[model samples]
Target: MMLFEKKSPYKQLLNLFLLSSFVLRIVLLFHPITTTSFSWAEIIKIFLTGFLTDFFVFITASSLIWLYLLFLSESKYTKPWGYIIFGGFLSLLIYVACFNTILNEYGGVLPEIGIGFVALKTTFFGLMLFLPKYRKHIRIALFSIAIFIITLIIIQNSISEFFFWNEFGVRYNFIAVDYLVYTNEVIKNIMESYPIIPLFIGVGIITAFFTYKIVKKSMPFLEKLPSFQEKIKSTVGYIALFALATFLVPVLAKQETSTNVFTNELQANGLYRFFLAFRNSELDYNKFYKTLPDNEAFTLLNQQLEIESNATSTQIIKGRTTEIKKNVVLITIESLSADFMKMYGNELNVTPFLDSLATKSTVFSNLYAVGNRTIRGLEAVTLCLPPSPGESIVKRKDNKNKFSTGSVFKEKGYSVKYLYGGDAYFDNMEDFFGGNGYDIVDKKTFKPEEITFDNVWGVCDEDMAKKAIQTMNAEAKTGKPFFNHWMTVSNHRPFTYPAGKIDIPNDAKSREGGVKYTDYALKQFFKMAQKQAWYNHTVFVIIADHCASSAGKTELPMDKYRIPAMIFEPGKEASINPILMSQIDIMPTLLGRLGFNYKSKFYGQDVYHPSYKPRAFIATYQDLGFIRNNILTILSPKQKVKQFDLSLQPSKLPVAFQLYYDEKPKNTIDPTLVNQTIGFYQTTATLLKNKRYQKK
Candidate 1:
């Protein structure tokens, strides 16, 4: 019996595609990480919107298959120009395969399943296209393979999405898009984080079962090809649907429609979002977001700058002439949060060394990271600008020769270098840092014997620490002050380290293990540093690139961005400074403490400056956040602005409450704060886009 009355025998397969997609979404909806506070009506709306998104995603994806099968008809298959159809398929395959590896040499990845794999696929495809008698058998084989793979992919994606939501509290976004560029690190990280073999075995079994059932029902129907007229009619009908979807999807699938971010996320398909993110990853502030007139924006910004500056005391120790020659060591750790240490309220004592070091260092008790990514942290500290919408400046193209914090060191006759445990080419770090007057010392510079233990991310923090000392020691011998910036990696996922260094065993593969090991490495690093000739002259700045997790119910969770920053000078008395600061402010504050002054393009201001007013700039790729005077103002895409009042959580235990916040929606936006918020983000976006963010 015919399974369908339709001209296309693959109708049942399409139904499976839609049904399976819907089922996956229903599972995600009830996921523990997904919010359960939605109203019944809202839930219905989510399903309704999701169905539309799924259909459009399906249509856009299936258009090529429609074209291929339509051309495979006997009438078209034997035509003189039939090779064009085969060439088109080959070209499409190659583009998709190679797309993720465009930046292979520059710290971008050439994926493990790269060009060579795609070529093999092309050869198989050519055989199916040229041989008519074997075509049906080949088609059956191809359908089975494709069906099996697609089943595995959607299932795997569902599993991946669950983990992603558990970690970051949202569907795929620019971070997922960024992962494509660094496929090796991400793939290895996943391997270390999960039991991949068992999961794949389970998934493959499920895939094989579905493939058998689907092909048994669907491919036999394809043996009796549709009449030429029937094929044309069906093909035309699908093409029209594809065109309609292409038109409607961008209109219907606006990402941030609802006030609740997760609600908006649940209403979209993950694969569609991933493709959309790749296409529109960087949203233009002026185009997609609210903005003031350029002159008015800058005027408000300059007014805020001057007004804040004039409100403070200008007196300071003013002898930068010779004291500027002091050496500086800046250590930016991965995912180090304030709550991970005893110095904060962490009962776990995961960072005993950092806690002890805090007793001897000036701790910025209220420092927050600008964004939730490593590249953003690097951009914040180096460029000292408000977070640019879309991608960080460090990863953006044409991001070279900027007036960064390193430029300040270079102008002050200091040797500046950016040292990392991993490849510097990743995230365009080498290009950005090297273009901005810093020497790059990364994984490639290390000798095999120098690396005692390593993982997919890079060398362990201890190994990198030793390298930092060696590099700085060599610079110290040259008789010049050096600014050495070391970015660590042990505090990252699959957080394995050399065993027995800390009380935590290496095999546990936990964040606590990572944090404790990082603390131990710091103790060892400082022990080695103190014995060096450059020790007495050096000032160490320890800060986080960003927190480990930034997930919360709120759109922009304030507490998650809270991280630690400390300035440790040898033999200096430790003091706790409760001034609110962002990652960008640390460099300006450090330079001010050292009494070095130069042409400034940095948006960050030293809290000690009489004109320094306290404010913190925080953001995601699309949400521009500004926190000051107990108000959090966010500038989002679609010119939407939101304001929330931030206050310390009321609790009996003061220590725990200090690091967190309670956000209450404001009924109205403050005009002054809103203008300043717009001014800061707009000016940064405009300046960077126009190549005007320079020390003039």
Candidate 2:
């Protein structure tokens, strides 16, 4: 211990470096408060997670490095403890540098723990190299630990996800695969082969023994350690160099690429934005990208916005829609296109039950849906809000702020209930529905006999329908007119028919078999409804969630978003009124028909109302289109415009359509209308964030 020796300058430099790095990380955390909004709880969680993760990683790496060096050193010219102190300082600096760089990139650090994990791995390697002889042992031990920790974290987070899948199997199979499939394999393996704890411990012990053998053969420890002053000099120099490198690499890379940190943060937290940025990797993005909107699309979208904004807030007078509100039972069919039904001019006898029901119901021959997904359809029908361009309304926390039909009915003292076979939390649907005054009945609430959790995505449509009927009957006993929103999941892709059902030879890739099976399930639901006491008074409004596959258009061609919407009241005479309509029109149309006096806070008008204009708006990612009385305006991302006159000439589009086909700003509607339309869109967008119709 050379107490008289001069103190190393390296030690003072290392201390300064750590202090500076800590202050830098603190600055990075506070920077996002001005640009991005994060709750106080969220910010604290981020800081704590970052602090704990880095602290443990540095301690672990330093400890392993020090132990290896102690055993693997020969002369001990450098003290082993000095190397560990250096490693610790280096790891801590690396953590801060990486954390700050990523935090700046990802608007906020809270959601991007992946960066921290990656940095930790890099730090482990750097520590192993601090002393060449000890590198072999450190590598083996660290690799084992890294693999175990990552796997454990994945398994832990997947527990709730797996439980939901086991409870609701095979539902929406074609839609999106659930996390249960991954954990289910692990669970099965755990039961038959190995327990988690023993497996981890076994790996750890093997790694430790292998490391020990390698170290023993490679190098021998020195009998006497070096002077303390000399050790301090070596440690401080190593730390200073590591700290300098950490701060420079990221800055240089970012500068050379012309990419800043803010965009990175946007990608981290903004799901849709991230999805768009990495669209090529996602199956949904590839399918949806083929439909980005052109200038004409935006123009048409703006027109719909104008229609909604200018139309009186009292567009549908109160008491206008009560004529048919006699305990309404609504069914949202999955992937059911209007073109598939025999009544709608399809050659296939796919939906005989729906056709029969339509014969006695007030069939809306020209109804439309706003968006192309289930959530979009639900939002349009229940809330009467237009789907945001290329984004899910459910993902937006402020969705409850948007105007909704549920709020209207709830205001009228009607009990609103929503029933789905899947996890209502997937798209935050439960919170949205619950916030809008709907009693949500999801898979968790279903009875054992009422539902079979055989689907990975959700419960089967048949089981969901049966549950709906039961709930309706129970609610009927209360004497309160109820509005029930039922969504079908069996018709989604990867459709699995019930056992012993007729199996169509539709290719595994073909959705035809699932569609056929879903039709059969729909039939079963209606057949049961006929025997229920609420049948006569109940207004069964049926609408498809979205189109399955449009044969005529690859991108939206004005009719891509077309779906059937009908009102079926048992024992009532049959009537069909065809008008150009869409998902936005459902709210105003339904409210008007039911004789509700409420003014719709929607972008749609009643097709039946004499003064109401007949228009339809459809969107596909960035693409949008407008349809009126007999004219259709098509817009594409390429700025191509195509117009068709449905009245005088159905087959041929006008040459002038091609003139405005590019639909440049000048070729579209007048400037005054454009500004007015754009203004309305901005206003409505603001309303969505304001929580307008939701009860505080």
What lDDT does the true structure give each of the candidates?
0.80, 0.53
Q: After superposition, how far is residue 264 of candidate 1 from its true place, in Å?
A: 1.5
lDDT of 2 by residue, 1-696 (tens): 111122221122222223322443344334422233445655554444333333322332233343333333323224666566556756665665665655556665543565565566456645655656876567546534543343333233223222222322111121223223245433542433334577657545644554343333323222233345555664565455446544543332232111222222211211122223343222232233223223443344444433333312323354543355577777888888766776656656667667777777777766666656677787778756545544456645565644577777777778989888887886568987887678998898877877653465577777887888888888888888898988887775556556655356533424566677677777888889889888877777888988774312123433446677787766768777766677777656667767877655666666676665566666543445555544455443333444444433232432211111111122343333333333333334444544454432
Predict model 2's lDDT versus the native.
0.53
- Runs in model 2 lying further than 4 Å from the true structure: 1-86, 89-325, 505-509, 549-555, 629-680, 689-696
lDDT of 1 at 609: 77
TM-score of each: 0.89, 0.58
Candidate 1's TM-score reads 0.89
